[model samples]
Target: MVAQDFIVDLNKPLVFQVGHLGEAYQEWVHQPIVSKEGPRFFESDFWEFLTRTVWWAVPLIWLPVVCWCISMSIRMGHSLPQISLMVVSGIFIWTLLEYTLHRFLFHIETKSYWGNTIHYLLHGCHHKHPMDGLRLVFPPTATAVLCLPFWNLVQLMSTPSITPALFGGGLLGYVIYDVTHYYLHHGQPSSEVPRNLKKYHLNHHFRIQNQGFGITSSLWDKVFGTLPQSKAAKKSR
Candidate 1:
């Protein structure tokens, strides 16, 4: 079935069919359907409802978490420069993590039935329906769940005085990543940098799927040699 014909109804439970298997799954991955209605993943209304989120919630949810971490770091007697360095380090760390996850986890290919479904729910849906405002940013609830393990990992490597600031910087980086990602999809950019970023990202979506994985900055893409070629180069070829 063509994607346009597929509709996810919140009022009803999902019933998977063989027709939605194999080739249909590949199409869903490569050429995602753009739908006016939100896609339903869970049968439980509460769980399904949590999947859809507003873009502004990224800052609203993470900014406070960042502030709390920094404030705690201050109370613990870290100097401004020390905290700044840790935070900067954290932001740097997040950029690598972002690129890694986008390139590796989000793009992993799976042929199994459940694998495709899970993949679609995680990232494929975004590719298929690029303009879905609800799915543009990671849901705060999901982000919070992920933050715990990441925070624990940071604590393992750093002192208490420095860990919060470091984690806070990482959080801030994530906020930037999400907001930048949303803007790349929905916002209009007049500046050259953002315009270039938007062009790079859209090309990743519409033209070259594997390249241009970095969203906030193309630094990782450049380092990893996955950066998309220039339009001039493509034209020449």
Candidate 2:
């Protein structure tokens, strides 16, 4: 049975209703709705604004940090080629990280009250209202919060000189992912690659949710056997 339009009471907390749907939650959340308006996460307008992110805000906020980190690596004695290699590696690593997060965290299967609420706030809202332009990109505030431990991890895993450049590359990959994600939802593609990507991503949103977890690149999907059940998969065999 197709899910009918759900009328969330703006006066009440959205989490209590949609978040407590239990078994009905998965199917309800997956059924995409076409609307520019997104549900309110909080009653406070000030806090609510933090939940919505403009796509341009990503690059505007992070690009300078990326450039700074890379430039810092150069000052720390890493050559351009070495820094470039680390940066590329970081971007490549980001692709795998992207796949892992999308599949494991964002799409986590849960039935607990808090779990469901968190899931809905983090990603289900996006799935439910796919066309809400404001929520397409993650809020910079949330991203900044996430960056702390990630930066520490990068520092520990790599040499000091490489860490800055590598982390910057990973950040760049994230920026590209967010922007590409927004464009895939809102932009018209005139080229083959983007056109296919748009199709691939839409398949994830409108078709099967278990597959095609990669956004900027489908490399992990092909490797992990989660590629969508479409002609592309058939041809790959």
Candidate 3:
């Protein structure tokens, strides 16, 4: 397909219109940057799609792969419900992975030489430019780099079939978690739950950097007992 120009009407939720297809897309709409809450930069449709479409599409890419896996698993003797369970299990596995990476890796305070360098390379850059498009999520190269080792490790004790099903599900979940984390930072939440999570995440960025460690959920913080306790203290005064 040829490249297309599109405009986003921020007033409408989650829709894009193609203006014209050309060598590249262009933006032809803009809205006033004013709101009851504060100033808002009404995003162009092209920009919104650029930000959102891939994240929306990622889990989709896994669906066919997962469906194939599920079908194969059933043919290989697993029940249909077990295949269904694999999908659900994949999501929960993603939660734990997301939590562990956020708490330990992203939040690791590096006082030494290489530690700080690696820390910044991995996440500090994102903290600095939370809005940078190219850096929104760890690129596929980075994902592959991190995923390969664990993928190999899982192979040591488990069947080859288990690896893809498990890893595909976990990777799908990671995509969701990573994109959700990005949205929590950059996109406006539609409901109270995400709004609250957004607030919790903002606190991680601005207020208490050490608290609100869980991005997908506060489950780990509650589980490990490291969740921030001082936000209320500051607010109650």
Candidate 4:
């Protein structure tokens, strides 16, 4: 398909067709097609509205949960040292989880109809419309639904006294990840850390979608051997 064939209507709701995965995926991963209008996944206005979320809403939705978790952990009589260690561990775990999910799950390839549709709905839409600010962050409703199994897993592994602290730290790490992701996409960074991160993330989106899965930190990418090729190396290739 030619560039002119992929026109998007700003006034109407963005509706992706069931096919066109090949051409659409190529354009999206390389030169992203940004849209001013939001996409509609459901016929119901309320359900469709639930899928869109603002960047600030991430912290607003999760911060209280994090605070409550920590408070509950303290009230449960867990020692400061234990709670501190567990919380830090949880944050560290989140980094790995982030990398794994991005690389393995979000980027999963499928050719079947329903599988491809699910994949597009989950992550492909973001790549296709990177500038759709409302859809950049994960919706709170989806996050809450996904957190059920994670919370259950935490409960199974740790005592109630320590679980809250651990879960709190993980939740905080997620907030950081989401906020940092939004900043990477939309904010201009003056500092070295964010500047480097912005470049790294943009490279992932435009140059090497398979590599550089780490968003909050590239340490995992470095360790997992998924770091994007250097500019010099790309030029040589």
- Most lDDT-accurate candidate: 2
Of models 1 and 4, which has the larger TM-score? 1
CA deviation > 4 Å runs, candidate 4? 1-16, 19-31, 35-37, 40-43, 235-237
| RMSD of candidates 1 onward, in order | 3.5, 3.4, 12.4, 3.3
Estimate every model's Cα lDDT from 0 to 1.
Answer: 0.83, 0.87, 0.57, 0.80
**Candidate 2 lDDT, 148-225, residue by residue in tens:** 888997898899888999999999999999999999999999999999999999989988888999999789999999
What's model 1's TM-score?
Answer: 0.88
Compared with the true structure, model 4 gives a TM-score of 0.87
The parts of candidate 1 lying over 4 Å away from their true place are: 1-20, 34-37
Alpha-carbon shift of residue 104 in model 4 (angstroms): 0.7
Model 4 lDDT at residue 159? 84
What is the C-alpha local distance difference test score of candidate 3?
0.57
In terms of TM-score, which candidate is strongest?
Answer: 2
The 10-residue segment with the lowest total lDDT in model 1: 10-19
Please provide, for model 4 over 64-110, each residue's C-alpha lDDT reduced to its tens digit, 9 standing for 90 to 100.
99999998988888888887888888898889989988999888875
Error of 3 at 70 (Å): 4.6
Model 3 compared with the native: what TM-score?
0.66
